[model samples]
Structure formats: structure tokens, C-alpha cells
Target: MESLIAALTLVVVGYIAGSVKIINEGNEGIVERLGQYRRSLKPGLNFVIPVFDTVLVETTREQVLDTDPQQAITRDNVPLTVDAVMYWKILDVQKAYYGVEDLESALTNLVVTALRGEIGQMDLRETVSGRNKINQALLHQLDEATESWGVKIMRVEVQEIAPSKTMLESLELERAAESKRKAAMSETESMVESIQRISRALQGQPNSQAVLQYLVAQKYVEANLKLSESDNSKIIFMDPKALTETIGELISTDQAELGNGNGNNL
Candidate 1:
């Protein structure tokens, strides 16, 4: 009778130990009885049949997925490299487990495919300027697609968008060329405006011819100085006084023609 009592006590203790389960906070467990899902276990103390029930525990907390940099192309045919991060939470662990074979891998691939698709619809400039727009669009797309997966897409963030090295170099060169063209145009416009002002100031002056000669000589000297500063410049010898006289004669002829036209109009 003593041996039988001892055996019964040991069996009771073993059953109690196996049936009692303590689940920590922020986690959940699914109970499968006889190879079929029976119930879900919540946080804190829970009970399950030890020998027949199997529990799989997973976190309920939010998770982060960092997608690797993926190659993509913009609408303007610019090849670029891009990557993003996604924030998600599992709403239904059963769906998360049974809905997909490999949850993480499926999510990653989905993100990569969506990222490339979004980028392909925008130009490089648009992609760079509208990163926030891109993120929102991705979030919407992912939310809709992940509904059946029992996953909540909290937010999608584009980490980086970088053009290829060759594209970057080409953009730099194009920008530099544009700058030079603009500078040249501005310089030419300023010179033309200055010349018009000078012509107006000298129109009714007595020593207008002398003033014009002096201005022409000054400009000739400045041109020579600029040429001398250039390493590849070839020195060309010319008579400054002769060149100034020729330009002054040309100016006089133009003024005379303008005066005749005005008189005719009057």
C-alpha cells in the first residue's frame, strides 16, 4: 500500500508540472491537439494537456524587415539602386504561419518587387524629390496585398535611392555644361546693355568721338591682358591705335545711318 501511494503521488506531480504553462508578456502560443490546432494561449498562466497538446510560441510585438539594396530603373531609363524598411505586426499568428510557407521570405520578395515597380513609373528627379510620396504609395499597396496574410503593414520607408556611377557622372557633366551656357548668355546680355547705355550717353556729347576712341583702346588693352593669362593663348601682335580708329569709323557710319532714318521718319 505504501509503494502504490508513492507511485500515484509521482504521477500526479508529473501531470501538474506538464499541464501548467507560464507565457510571458508580448507573446502568444498556439495549441495543437493531436496534430490539429485546438486553441490559442494568451499571456500569463495557461493550462494544456502535456502529452497530447503541442504549443508553438511566437512574439506579438511589431517586427522590422530591412530589405537589401535592389537594382531598379526609373521611367527615364536611368538605372538606380534602392532599398527600404518595412514595419509590420502579426494580427493572426495562425494565418501568418499557415497562410505563407516562409513568412519573412515572402514579405521580403513582395517588398522588393513593389519597390522596383514604383520606381519604374517615375523619373530620376521625381524619385529623388518624391520619396515621401513613394513611401505612402508603397504602404497602401502593401496594406492591400498583405490583408490575407494576417499582417498589418504599419509603415514603409524608402531607405535610399542612388543612381549608377555612370549615370551620376553623366548628370554632373550635363549640369556643368548647363551652368557654363547660362553664364555665357548672362555675360553677353550684360555687355549688350552696357554698350546701349554708352551709346545713349555719348549721343549729344561734343567729345563723343574722343570718348569712343578712349573706350575702344581701354577694351583692347583688357582683351590683351585676358589672353595673356591663358596658358594656351597665342600672342597676336596688332596696332591698338589703328584698331581703335577702325572701330570708331564703323561706329560713326552706324550713327549717321540711324540719324538719317530718324529724319526720314520725322
Candidate 2:
């Protein structure tokens, strides 16, 4: 009789020990009974039947996952590599355990597939410029799909987009050519403005010939002084026709002034 009592006590102790469950903070356990999902267990102490109940899965409070870069062709038929990361958490442990075989693998694959679809619908420029749009689209798609899986996608971020080396080089060359063309255009415009200013200045001056001759003489003298200071002293030469024209214009001015004086006296 004492032996039977001892055996029954031992069996009860074993069942109690096996039924006791302790879950840490930031984690949840999904319970299964007789090969069917029963209920989810929250953090801290809990209880379950030894042979009739089992923890099918345990889920964390939050999870971060980095996805590999996917090579995809854009709408413009340009191929690019895109990589991203995601933040997620299990809201329903029961669904998380039963809804998907491998949630992490499924989520990663889903993200890659959605990213490819998003990028494929955009041009290369749009894909590069519209990262926010792509992220939003991915979040929407992931949220919808993960609803059944009991995973909530907190955020999705594009880590990087790397174009091919050849494509990058071509884009850089195009930018450089555009900049060079703009610079050349600006210089030509400045030259045109300077020419126009000189033309207007010449037209405004009545003694334009004398003024120009004086400027030329001043430049010649400066050049001569510079040459004298150098080892190679050079004789500055003037065009004979230019000198003759300057002298003729000076004589014509004097004659006109004298004729005006004579007319006043008369």
C-alpha cells in the first residue's frame, strides 16, 4: 500500500513539473493540444498538460531582418541592384505559428518579390528617385500578406541601390558634358556683352578716332616699358596707315573748329 502511494505521488510530481511553463519577457508561446493549435501563452509563469499540450512555437517581441540585394530590370529596361531591411513583430503567436512554415524566410522572400515588382513598374530614374514610394508600396503589400501570419510590418527601408559601373560612368559623363556646355554658353554671352558695350561706347564719343589712337599709344608705351625691363629689348612698331589716319582726323577736326569761328565772326 505504501509503495502504491509512493508511485502515485511520483507520477503526480512528474506531471506537475512537465505542465509548468516559464516564458521570458518580450516573448510569447503558441500552445498546441493533440496536434491542433489551442491558445497563445503570454510572458511569465503558465501551465499546460504534460502529454496533451505542447508549445508549437515561440515568438519574439520584435525582429529586424535584412534582405539581400535583388537584381531586377526597371520599366526602362535598365537593370539595377536593390537591397532593403524591415522591422516586424508578432502580434498573434498562434497565427504566427500556424499561418506560415517559416515566417522569417517567408517575409524575406516576400519583400524581395514585392521590391522587384515595384522596381519593375518604374523607370530607372523613377526607381532611384522614388525610394519612399517603393517603401510604402512594400509596406502595404507586406502588411496585407502578413495579416494572416499575425506579423505587423513596422517599417521598411531601402538600404541601397547600386547601378552598374558602366551606367554610373555614363551618367557622370552626361552631367559633365552638360556643365561644360553651360559654361561655354555663359562665356560666349559675356563676350557678346563686352562687344556690345564697346560698340555703344564708340558710338557715344564724338572723337572716337582720337580716343582710340590715344588708347593704342598708351598700350604701346606700356608694352615698350615692359619689354625694356626684360633681357630682350624690342622696338615697338606702329602701322603706317593707322598713324596716317589718326593725323588726318586731327587736322580735319582743327579745320572744322576754325571754320566755325569764321562763321561766328561773319
RMSD of each: 5.2, 10.8
After superposition, candidate 1 runs with Cα above 4 Å error: 190-257, 264-266
lDDT of each: 0.86, 0.80
- lDDT by residue for model 1 over 137-210, one digit each (tens)? 99999988988988999999999999999989999979977885687477647654555467656786788777
Error of 1 at 21 (Å): 1.8
Please, what are the lDDT tens digits per residue for candidate 2 over residues 153-208?
Answer: 99999988878777889889789778856874775476445434443456445786
Q: In order, how many clashes per candidate?
A: 0, 0
> Which residue pairs collide, candidate 2?
none
> How high is the lDDT of residue 149 in model 1?
87
> Please, what's the RMSD in Å of model 1?
5.2
Model 2 TM-score is 0.65
Which structure among the candidates has the greatest TM-score? 1
Query: Whose lDDT is greatest here?
Result: 1
Which consecutive 10 residues in model 1 have the weakest lDDT in total? 187-196
